[model samples]
Target: LDQIILNLVSNARDAIEDNGRIDIKVSTGSSEDILEHNSIVKPNADKYCLLTVSDNGSGIDEEKLDKIFEPFFTTKSAGTGTGLGLATIYGIVKQNNGYIFCESKKGRGTTFYIYFPESDEKPSEKQLIGKETKPDEQVSSTDKKILLCEDDEGVRNVLSKMLGAAGFNIIEAADGEEGLRKFKENKDDIFCVVSDYVIPFKNGIELYEDITSMSPDMGFILVSGYSHDVDNIAELNENRNFSFLKKPLKPELLKRTIMDIAKHGND
Candidate 1:
């Protein structure tokens, strides 16, 4: 569920080259009103749950919309991006017994409507993301500083709030390049780095490689919404001063990871 949100938001961010608005709205309706021109959405849904992400970015051309969900079929420049974002979103929604539809015009921006069959079963709290309803019960905080690198503004805000409430000072970066710069500037003071695996300019691996070369004992945590990032880290063949977490972080889980790394730094 978190991966779905991250991919859609990231795609929207990439679409807008300049200032634009992205609106996320949720509504519910009967299957009849929402399902049209698609035979797949008819049988499985009685009522539908709609999560729409609308963006005022450079919209897709009619010719390209059909191929948008195809894996590795990106229109981005070479060495810039992957078509995997949309393809992953499509697969996740479908696996949850849902469907995704896109509406767009060349210059009018785009909206993606995701329909999920409303389910009565709520995931147990153990499976929930950002599980901080019991904040007082969370791991204690420290005075150390943490470097947070993520390109998405909304996600960065939420994470900052969570970590700040836990009593740590956060040094922020919008992308991998800025993150590396800050690391160099504050190398002597920072206790650890918590960064997204798929960041712009330079990826988490590059940042990790460069930083660990300079401060081999500095604690590092690499995160991403993509599972294959795990495979990438595995290729490194050594895991020291390093750990990883999948995206849509649970609050207590993140707090524990950070505390552990900070403790290691103290040692």
Candidate 2:
């Protein structure tokens, strides 16, 4: 919910070149009212929470509305976005047992409504403080082997070098298919699979599934420029041992994620 709100706000800000209005409204609606008025099925009895974000910027066309939630689908220019914002939000909300609806008309405005089932359970509060690390302190990799899969050559090179410098033995693959092949060949030597979500042949999720079947205890990390339906990733994080890092990730973040995986070995 927090992530989705951030993405929507960021997108609205980008759409408006100058000053514009963005309205965020939250309320509770009865199940009957929601079903009749919003044309959405209520997940439970009584009431549900409704969150609506409206922006008075350039509105989307009707045709594009359906595609906005798809991974890598974007109207923005190259280097502007990875088109994973909405997709990621969609995945998150669904995972949390929620639903979303969007409305827009060209030259008017756009509004997104998110519905979440009401719960009597109190929300748990936990504050995450960022780990402090010194710049001079090098992250050691302990001769552990890693299967690195990334389609972009530039990103691939930088990541491989960074991991290699940390003392990891890097086995590189350009796409998912190659990643799987390398994993099979180096099953004994490899300590983890670091892969990009979007790739050729098969996707990161599919690769994760295949690798887990062969080596259930293997560690995996998924990196992506945009967000997607991360239910599988979340499940793996909960049931097995894996990590996910969003793209444009700093070196420190990557190091921390790897170290976390190495230390904990999943829940």
Candidate 3:
């Protein structure tokens, strides 16, 4: 819910150029109302919670509304946006068994409607337990290390926390060059390398090549916000030791990938 609200509000702010109004309203409605709004039948629920975010800004083009939820589809200038915000919102909505619809007019304005099944049950807090470690992942060595290379500090910290929670020792670096150097220093103990495609000094692919030259079977995962970035890395397909993940990564997916690599020896 926090992610959905933050992304929607952020996108609304970006759309406005001047003194524009952004409105957010939350209300309760029935399933019949939802079906009328999107014409899509959702799971039967007695009541639903509706969230509406509307903005009077440079609205999206009618044709582009359909593609707004797609990954890497952004109206912002290059380098200004990753185009993952809306896509992330869409995924989150769907994951919660919710529905989302967007209405926009080029010059008039834009509005987003999100619906989630209302639950009367009180929210329960549950501890998050890490997945069971596969037998193959339990190497004789005490250290289960992952070399994490990401330029963004926030993203780096988040990934670090996630890996750390999964019982992996994290060696962090801000860029490709630092990552490579760290990998070399810890080469004997490092189990996997997780890196972003674009970074200072050297790119992810170059880093992959340099490290693989010495350890051909080194487990590596490359992450990128742009799909084309992965497509351009021909070495990825040829190397069984390497895998690529598109940005806006989910924690479960990341952990699963690492476990798979560990269990299979990156083969």
Candidate 4:
């Protein structure tokens, strides 16, 4: 939700040439009310929440509305945006058993509606923990094999070489389907699966499920350009001890995540 809000705000800021209006409305309701009003299923039956962010700026063209959520589909200039923000948000919302809808008109405005399942449990407050600054120089000798799944050829090659140079044998897969095949074939030899969240055929989460079902101890790291709802990722991380690395990834962050998982074995 934080990421989604940030992306919307940033996009709105970019769209506005001088001054514009951004309206943020948050509401809580029951499944029945949501269904009655919105004509959409409440993400969860017991309770539900709705968050809407609307921006009065340069709106999207009608033609691009359907493609906005497609991965790598962006209207922004190269290097300005990854085009992954909306897609990532869609994936995150879907993963969390939620639904997202966007309404926009060229020159009019844009609005995004996000519906989340609710619970009686209180929301947990989180404390900010600064990143570890002290580096652990202890080199790992674990000859663990990793399944590297990435759609981008350049990213895949770079990560494969880096992991290989780190004394870890890597099985490279171009997309999610191939990754799943390789993982199933080398289930015993594979120690972990590092995958891009957006891939051809299937996605990282789908692959994670397939691999983990076969090898209960199998580890996963999801690399993506952006995210919509980090809470969904947090829930997964807490439950499965999986890790996520945001894109435009730094080599250091990747190495740290790998080393942490390799050393502690997901706690």
Candidate 5:
């Protein structure tokens, strides 16, 4: 929710000229209201927390509205926007069983209405991330060390926390080269190599190939943020020693997967 709100606020800010105002309001609503307000043609569930962001800025046009949710669609000048902001936000909201609606006119202003379903049940791993550990994942095993290779420091820190909480011992590196070096230095100790698909010095496949040459049955997991990079959720490897996870890595899947390595062995 924080992420979605921030992106919307940022968009609102970008839309504004001079000192235009942006308003954010959160209120409870029923599904009937969602339909009546045209916030959603038909919301799937009953209760909702409606988020409305309004900007008194240069409003979007009717022609552009249809394409706003499309990936890489932007009205801002080149270098001012990446065009992935709304697309990513749309993905996140819909994935969590929510709805998004927009109201705009060329000269007036633009407002976005987001309807997030309210649930008493705890969020699933696919919903809100970083829920409590699974029953089986509660057991800690420090011996199952992981070579975590990610270029971004912020992502690495967050992932390190999740890995530690999930009970795996960590060996970190900034990029594929450093990751390979760490893997070599601790070859015997490192049971699994979890690497970012795109990184400096060497790519993930190259790193995997290099390590696998030395340790053919090395447990490997290729991690990537882009959805297109991983086509074979089919299986990370035919031998069951390889796997993959998309980023903004969810806690439960990460724990379950790393633990799978321990239970199944390096193979």
Candidate 6:
């Protein structure tokens, strides 16, 4: 769910180069309405949670709209895009039995509508047991500072708020370049770095390599919405100072990982 929102919003923001608007709406949708956009739905579910992301920018050409969700298919020039964002979004939505559709015109604008089936089942006893727990008290407070690197503003803001409410000082950066710069500036004070696996300028691995070279004992947590890349990083698994998490993040898990790293920073 987080990945869907992050990638869609990020793409919309990028499309709007300047002085453009992006709108997000969430509402209930019916199977009949969703069938107009997607044909694969089995129609076993009657209701869905509709997510709409729209941008008033230089829209896409009809010819390219069909290929937007294909891996490595990009309209942007050269090194600007990997084109995996939309593919990832499509795969995630489909994996969860959801439907995604896009509408665009060359000069008008673009809008993406996603339909996720609404489950009527209530939470189980196991899930309900911890429903009232306080997230802030789940992990011990630390005097150490954390470096947060993520390109999407919305994701970053939510993460910052979560960590801040847990009583930790946070230093934020929008990309790997700025993250590296800030790490160099406050290398002495930072206790751990929580960064997205994929970021601009440099990736998480590069940032981890650079920072670990300078401060070998620095605690690092690498996160991602994509799972295919996780198996390739054998080093992250071997390193005692490093950890990885998949999104959408579980707040308790993130907080516990950070606190564990902080408590055992010198070990």
- Candidate 1 lDDT trough over 10 residues, lowest sum: 131-140
Ranking by lDDT: 6, 3, 5, 1, 2, 4
Who is ahead in TM-score, 3 or 4? 3
Error of 3 at 117 (Å): 2.6
Compare candidates 1 and 6 on TM-score and give the better one.
6
lDDT of each: 0.79, 0.78, 0.82, 0.77, 0.80, 0.85
- Inter-residue clash pairs, candidate 1: none
Q: Write one digit per residue (lDDT tens) for candidate 4, span 74-182.
A: 9887866788778878988899887777888888788888878876676445424534345454545356888999876655776787778878898999988999998
Give, for candidate 4, the lowest lDDT window spanning 10 residues.
123-132
Give the best candidate by TM-score. 6
Q: Model 2: per-residue lDDT, tens digit, 1-267?
A: 546776787677666646788899999856665566466464655667888998888889899998999998987889668787788889878897777888887777788888787877765453244444675443456667889998866567777887887778899999999999999998998878888888899889899999999998888888876455565655666754688887645565776677666656523
TM-score of each prediction: 0.72, 0.49, 0.63, 0.49, 0.61, 0.73
- Backbone clash pairs for candidate 3 read none
- Tell me, what's the RMSD of every candidate? 4.8, 10.9, 6.7, 13.1, 7.0, 4.6
Model 3 collision count = 0
Off by over 4 Å in 1: 17-19, 121-137, 149-168, 173-181, 195-210, 213-215, 223-240, 244-267
Per-residue lDDT of 33-128 in model 6, one digit per residue for the tens?
A: 887877775655899989999999889999999999999898777865678888988999889888889999877789999988998998799787
Report the lDDT of model 4 for residue 9: 65
Measured on C-alpha atoms, candidate 2 has an lDDT of: 0.78
Winner on lDDT between 1 and 3 is 3
Strongest candidate by lDDT: 6
- Number of clashes in every candidate structure? 0, 0, 0, 1, 0, 0
What is the Cα-based lDDT of residue 245 in candidate 5? 75
- Superposed model 6: Cα runs more than 4 Å off: 38-42, 122-137, 140-142, 149-167, 172-181, 195-210, 222-232, 244-260, 263-267
After superposing candidate 2 on the true structure, give the runs of residues whose Cα lies further than 4 Å from its correct spot.
1-140, 265-267
